[model samples]
Target chain A: MTGLADRRPEEDSVAMPRVSFTENLKRHVDCPPQDAAGGTVRAVLENVFADNPRLGTYVLDDQRRLRKHVTVFVNREMIADREGLSDAVGEGDEVFVFQALSGG
Target chain B: MTDAFHVATRKGLFRYERRNGGWQAGAPAFLGEPVSAVLTDPRDGAIYAALRLGHFGQKLHRSRDGGTSWEELEAPKFGAEPPPPSPANAENFEADMAARKAAQTVDTIWIMTAGGADQPGVLWAGTLPGALFKSKDHGESWSLVESLWNVPERAKWFGGGADLPGIHSVHVDPRDSAKLTVGVSCGGVWKSDDGGETWRQAGQGLRAAFLPPEMQYDPVSQDPHRLAHSGDTVWCQHHNGVFLSRDGGESFTEIEEAGPSVFGFAVATHPDDPESAWLVPGVKDETRVPVDGKFVVTRTRDGGKSFEALSNGLPDGPAWDLVYRHALDIDGTGERLVMGSTTGNCWLTEDGGDSWICVSTYLPPIAAVAWA
Candidate 1:
């Protein structure tokens, strides 16, 4: 069976998009800025969460949908699909996730 | 009998210790965070606290050395949705699809209870969205009790005070570890004879005045604000009135008269006597404040035949304190009881509600209180 340890070292050299989290979430769980490889918003977030699974819980609900008070913006435009998270992402794209100013 | 008690509040988890003939508050843990539930396992000295973060979702923490130190543990959560049914199986395809499509998440860990003495490392958690979870290894992990959640009658469950229905009371019968009774808001009472493998809707005589006249007596529609048990009898401070069930939870008889009003959210039953229980009486429905600006704790000793309003050491007039379901607790000896309210006032009774002393009046809105 193929495992993470068996992957080729060259695959790590590929360029990926940078994902950053809101400062408010740092108090609960850690989510430092990092680079992950993916083609869509869901894929990119999931890719980063693959290494830090606990961060995924802070951003998503049990149904794996983005939380009601969390918003994600790719570069400048906000992601259109909150549930499916199907917005496209390009190489070296800047993804910013922020907590909405709704709840106290 | 207990020297210490933990209070989960809107701001943090506070511990009160009986020191120098008075209860003293210690340094708060998780300061500036909302603690929804607190449980101190009687079998073991371990303490578990459930936090409901407004921004980061729900979290659970365990403290072994009282409340001095804590370790973060995975909170109870719902599992992934089940696979959709095939088109050939059209018996109840639409209903099945709709049920499956309505995804559920753990909005709040409303209550947590330690399993019976036989089950050492077991724990039970009831959460918002009306789901039960079991943890065999303390609070490290959890799994949904599908037997209770998948019941067909669960579709009728709806929200009461919160936006979604919540299971606020989980009572594990001391006589038998397998016998379990859980009280849900707007979902009536449910009993499981063989642990949580299966469940049945109980609480036969419960009535819901909020519903239409025709459905007032419906079993599944009754909203029990809190359920407390002592010995074989169960006491329920329902939304409409105070109901008592002598046979576990199979049936109930409403106590038509309880002090100034029969409506409240919290109930504390004596540990040794089934007929003795205490409830905080309040004006029901729209204005959930003290009846006529008089706050009192109503005690029934003659098995609901009569009740007395105990107000000594409490507020005299123009007081508004609404206690939540888990904010009232009785110690093992049943002599000492503590209660906190939404208005940040706490009272402690040393002589079983005959009188009470104000413990704290400046803490954040209290959610749950447990004797450690």
Candidate 2:
């Protein structure tokens, strides 16, 4: 009901996490816009957080330089300028997460 | 982690320990310091201890008739386990010297378990990428079972908890050798059938609760920090809290009875009974908290059907630090228990956690400890 109440036919939709997803490493977070304006990686991610606080920690950190284990790809190739927000974001970009991969 | 050390909960943790040592230090907790030891033969009141893995892995010191005298267990001909064949290994000083020490350190028989389980074979030394090299012939020539490596999920190895492919605990059910379980730091609990010939990821239901968005697996710990078998249920001090599994990890039920730190490590089970176990929570921030421990040892009297917090004599109020599972133990005598924490404190209970005592206050973030 909360999701529906927030929806407006004149506006757009957002991507939100579902409930009871099962897994201890989880927190409640809300939706992201289906379409947003951002020609850069940080811009799009920030755009995600702008509408959903849940997407904040999931994408960016306190220092906000991509965590070593976290990888962001543009067309399946790894990004080089992980720090700068100047990296170009083309149409239909995708993000993938892979933790630092600790232990043995 | 700076203060993490070992605590010999009782004379039942491992099959080696001096009869009279204050605070009962068992198994010489390593990585990289061990202090105040009394390795004894016990029968003839003969005390002998091997304090080789000492500071900087430099020398091997042995003591007879307690810590009153010392000897060295080094043989010129013997060599440490060979390096993993990395030329870069030479660049790493600790690696080269450590390799030499590990290879040469086993020349003379010091530990009672060196003679095998029937004799003195309680501690099973393991290596990275997960290998079970047993010294059944009394540390003469180590044999690699390679069974753990062959398990289908071998690729999932260990990296989360403690950041290493770990074979931390080797549990032998005296009633049945085939009924064995080993705790992989981050990969969770693994059970071997037919003497470790085959293994299955018994921690299926254990989920990563606070995984970072970038985290592919739970941080360094296997499903949780530790695994203890109580009847059909395998309880653990998970990355989340106390968890229970029935049907040999085929399914699970989380027991909400855990914490001193919601973000911590280590979980241990009692020796004789299925209903008993222990956990030491870790403090998250840079500051150290508490004295004995934040949330002390918690146990389920009836196999986790129910649980109660056991903080009778433990450090209470304003405490923070991560206490691992391997550091907590219930002695074989069935009357005692203990937990070693990163705060440089070891809490003891000779009455099954009904009460507590801060026995030892100087040990590292304890890795593993056993009592004989």
Candidate whose DockQ is highest: 1
Instruction: Show where candidate 2 strays beyond 4 Å.
Output: A1-104, B1-123, B210-221, B230-233, B248-251, B257-263, B283-295, B362-365
Best by TM-score: 1
lDDT of 1 by residue, B246-342 (tens): 9998999988998889989999899898889999988987789999989899998989999999999999878999988899999988889999999
Chain B TM-scores across candidates: 0.95, 0.65
Clashing pairs in 1: none
True contacts kept of 2: 0.00
TM-score of each: 0.92, 0.54
Compared with the true structure, model 1 gives a TM-score of 0.92
Q: Where does model 2 sit among the CAPRI classes?
A: incorrect
